[model samples]
Target: MLPSPFAFERPSTIAGAVRAVGKSGDGMFYSGGTELLLALKLRVIHTDRLIDIKGINGLDRIALNDANDIELGARCTHNKIANDPVIRAHVPALSSLCANVANIRIRSVGTIGGNLCFGEPHADPLTMLAALDARLVLIGPSGTRVVHADDFIRSELETVREPDELLTVIAFSRPTGPVTYRRFKHGERPSVNVAMAWSLGPSGRTIRSARVRVGALGSRPQPLKAIEDVLQGISVAEVRPAIEAVLPTALGELEVNEDRHGGAEYKRHLAGVLLLRNADEAIAAAGSA
Candidate 1:
C-alpha cells in the first residue's frame, strides 16, 4: 500500500529539524529511510511531515574525539561505518557487524541512528553498542542530553527519544582490550546475538572489567551481569572456565521471547553459545596481544 500524502521539509540545521518535528507533533526526522519508508508504505507508521536532516552538516561524520572516544554521526550509513578507518581501527567488531547488516543495499543506505530509533529487537547495532558502552547524544528544543545505549531503547519498537528530539551522535570510549561479536540468524534479522568487550589490566594478562550484552532474545539488549562478574579480575587462562560456571545462570536471567525466531529455550541457548564464542575470540586476542 502507498503511504498517505505527507509534507516533506528539508532543514539545514539540527535546531530547525527539531523545531519542524516538534511543531507538527506527528513529524519525523528523515535520513536513510530504509525502515521508515517501509513502515510508512505498510501504514504501520504515518507521519504528517518528514523533516529531512541530511542537509544538516556534521550529522554524517565519523571521527575520533580528543578524549579517544569514537563519535559516529547519527546520519552515517552501515556501509560508511563498516569501511571507515577510524571505526575499523577502534571497534573492528562493530565494523564487521555493519558490513554484514542485511545486505549491501541496506548497509549502503540504512543509517545507524534510524536503526536505533526504530528500536527493533532483532537488530544488530544496538547490541554491539551496548557492549561497547556507547553513549547516544539526543538534541531537542528543551536541551541536549546523553543517554547510555542500554537506556536508549525502552522496549520493542520503542525508544526513549521524544518526537521532538534528534539523535545527533553515538560516542563510546575506544575499547581498551578485545571486542568481539557473534550472532545466529535464519533470515535478515538475527535470532540471537552477543557482544563482549573486555578491559584488560595494564599487564594485559588479567581482566579488569567486562561487558556482555545478549540481543534478539528480548525487547532490548540485556547485560549478562553474572558472567561479567565472574570474568572480572580473572586471568586470561581462567576466563573460559569462569564464564562456563556462570553461563547457565546468566542465560536464564535473560527475558526471551518465543517469536518467529525460535522457541524461547532455543534462543536462550543460542545466546550462551554466542557468548562463549565471543569469549574465545577475546581470549585469542589477548593471547596474541
Candidate 2:
C-alpha cells in the first residue's frame, strides 16, 4: 500500500503548526506518523499536507506542571514515557501500559498524542487515561482550552478537536492510591482493556474512591460509573465480590459491537475479567502498604 502525494512540513513552533493546519482542514498535524501514515496508506484518511510538530520545542518534555499536574508533551513517544523515571514512580500503571503498547517497534516510534488522535477503539491508552481522569490541552490559532479525557474522543477515529487545533499536552493529578491498568491483547492491539484506579484513606484499607473504565468494546472507552460507585469506600478485601455483583450490569451498559476482535458477549466478559484483575492488583498494593 502507498499513500497519496502530500506536501510535508516541519513547524518549529506551536503557533506555526496551528497556522499550517489552518481553518479549512486540508492539513494535519503529524508527529510520530505511526497512525497517520498507516491510515494514509490504507486510504482511510487523506490530507494534502502534513505539518510535523516534532520540531517544536518543549512539546516533547514530560514533567509536572505548575498546576500540580503531571504534564506529558503530546510528542512524547511511548518508549519515552515507558522508560521515564518520573512516570514509573508517580504512575507506574501508565508506564507499564506504555511499555506494553503494541510491540517494541511501535513503542519506540508511536506518540501518545498520535494514539489518542487516531482514536482507535482497540488501543490501550484511552482506558487508562480515562481512569486517571486526565485532561488534554488543545492549542489553536484562536486560543487554548482543556478537554477532559472522557470528552476528547467523540467516536471511533473522531474527536472534538477542530482541524486547526493541535493537542499539546496530557495532564493528570498524581494518584492518591494504587493505580492499575490491564488489557487483553488479541494481536498487537487490545481486544478489551480495563483500567482501575483508587483513592485510599489514611491507612490504605478503605477505598475513598475509584475510577473504572472499559475500552475496545465501544466507540470509545466508556466509564463503568456503576462499578465505580460500588467500589467507593469498600474495604480492599471485599473489592472482588462487591465489583462482581455489579459487573454484569455495568458491562451491559457499554456499547459493545462485534468486530474482528470477538463477539460482544465474550469481549464484555473479558472486560469484567480485566477489571477484576486490576482490582486484585490494587488489593495487593493496599495490603503491602
Candidate 3:
C-alpha cells in the first residue's frame, strides 16, 4: 500500500523544522526516512506533513566534546558511524554494532535518530546506549531537554519524544573500561540482545561497576540489576562463577513476552546466556587493557 497523501516541507534550520512540524500538528521530522518511509507505505503510521531536516547544518557530525563525552548528531547514518575514527577509538563495540546493523543498504541510509524515534523493541542501538548511560538531546519549542537513553523509550514502538521535538544528539561519557554487546537472532531483528558496560578499578582487573541491558525480550531494553549487583567489586577471574551463581534469579526477574521470537521462558534463558557471553568478552578486554 502507498502512504497517505502528505505535504512535504524542507527546512534548513532546526528552529524552522520544529516550527513547521508543530504548526502542522501532525507533522513528523524526516531524516534518513528508512523506517519512517516504510511505516508510511505500510500505513502503520500517518502524518499530514514531513518536515525534512536534512538541509540543517551540523546534525550529522560526530565529535568528542570538551568534557570528553562523545556526541553523535541525530542524523548520522549507521554507515558513517561504523567507519568514524572517533567511534572506533572511543567505543569500538558500538562501531561494530553499527557496521552490522541490518544490511549495507539500511546502514547507508538509516539514521540513528530515526531508529530511536521509531522505538522498535527488537532493534539494537537503544539497548547498548542504555547500558552505556547515554543521554539523548531533544530540542523543541520550549527549549532543549536531555533524557537518559533508558527513559527515552516508553514502550514498544513508542518513545517519550513530543511530536514537535527534534532529537538532536546522543551523548555519552567515554567508557572507563570494557563495553560489550551480544545478540541472538533468527530473522531481521534480534530475538534477544544484551549490552554490558563495565567500570574497572585502578588495577584494571577488578570490576567496580557494571551495567547490563537486555533487549528484544520486553517492551524496551531492561537492566539486569541482579546481575549487575553480583558482578560489582569482583575480579575478572571470578566473573564467570559469580554470574553463574546468580544467573537463575536474575533471569527470573526479566519480564519477557512470548512472540514469534520464542516463548517467554526461552527468551529469558537467552538473556542469561548472552549476559554471560558479554561478561566473558568484557573480562578479556579488561585483562588485555
Candidate 4:
C-alpha cells in the first residue's frame, strides 16, 4: 500500500514536538503508527506532515504514584502495559485486555495513546478505562489538561482532543474490588465488549458501587447507568439477577449502530451476553478476594 508523501519530524522532547507542529492544521502527531499508518495507507486520512512524538523522553513509562494511582505513559506500547509488573498487580484486568489487543505485532507497536486518539469504536482500552474512571492527560502547545476517560472520546473515530493536543498519560486510582471484562469478537477486534468494575463494601461481601460500560456497538463506550444503580448496595448473592433484570432495559437505551461488526440487534444482544459473562467473573473474583 502506498501512502501519499508527507513530511515527517522526530523531536527529542515534548516541547520541541509541540512547537514543530506549529499552527498547521494539516499536521498530526504520530506515535507507534499502528492505526495511523493503516489510515494513511487507506487514504482515509490525509496530512501534509507527521510529527513523531515517540522520540520524546519518558513517554513510555508506567508507574504507581504515592497515592497508589496508576500513571500509564501514553507512548507505552500494549506489550509494555501487558507485561508491566505494576500494571499486572494493580489492574490485572487491564493487563489482560492489553495482552489480548489485536495480534502480537500490533500489540508490540500500538501505543495506548495512539489507540485512544484514533478512537476506534471496537477497541478495548477505552471501555475498561471508562469503567475504571481513568483520567487522560493531554498536552498541547499551550499547556496540559486532564480529562476523564468517559469524556475523552466523543464518538466513533473521534475524540475530544484537538489536533494540536497529544495524550501523554492515562491515570486511574486502583480498584477496590475485582474488575472484569468480556468481549464478543468474530474477528480481530471485538464486535461488542463489556467492562464492569465494582467497589466492595467494608465487609467485602456487599457491593458498595459499580460501573458498567458497553462498547463496540456504537460510536463510543456507553455507561449502563440503570444497571449500575440496580447493583449498588446489593449483596454478592444478588449480583447476577439484579444486573440481568435491568440489563434488557439498559441495553435497549444504548445507541447501537448497524455496522459491519453486526446488525444493530445482534450487537445489542452480544452486549448483554458479554456483560453477563463479565459479571460472573467479577463476582467470583470478589468472592476469592
Q: Backbone clashes in each candidate structure, one number apiece? A: 0, 0, 0, 0
lDDT of each: 0.93, 0.90, 0.93, 0.90
Which sections of candidate 2 miss by over 4 Å? none
lDDT of 2 by residue, 80-124 (tens): 999988899889989999999999888999899999988888899
Query: TM-score per candidate, in order?
Result: 0.99, 0.97, 0.98, 0.97
Clashing pairs in model 4?
A: none
Candidate 3 per-residue lDDT over residues 203-223, each given as its tens digit: 998999999999998889999
| lDDT of each residue in 112-182, candidate 1, tens digit only | 99999999999999999999999999999889999999999888899999989999999999999999999
Error of 3 at 124 (Å): 0.7
**The candidate that achieves the highest TM-score relative to the unseen native structure:** 1
Error of 3 at 16 (Å): 0.8
True-vs-predicted CA distance for residue 22, candidate 3, Å:
1.5
Deviation (Å) of 9 in candidate 3: 0.9
Off by over 4 Å in 1: none
lDDT of 2 at 240: 91
Backbone clash pairs for candidate 3 read none
lDDT assessment of candidate 3 = 0.93
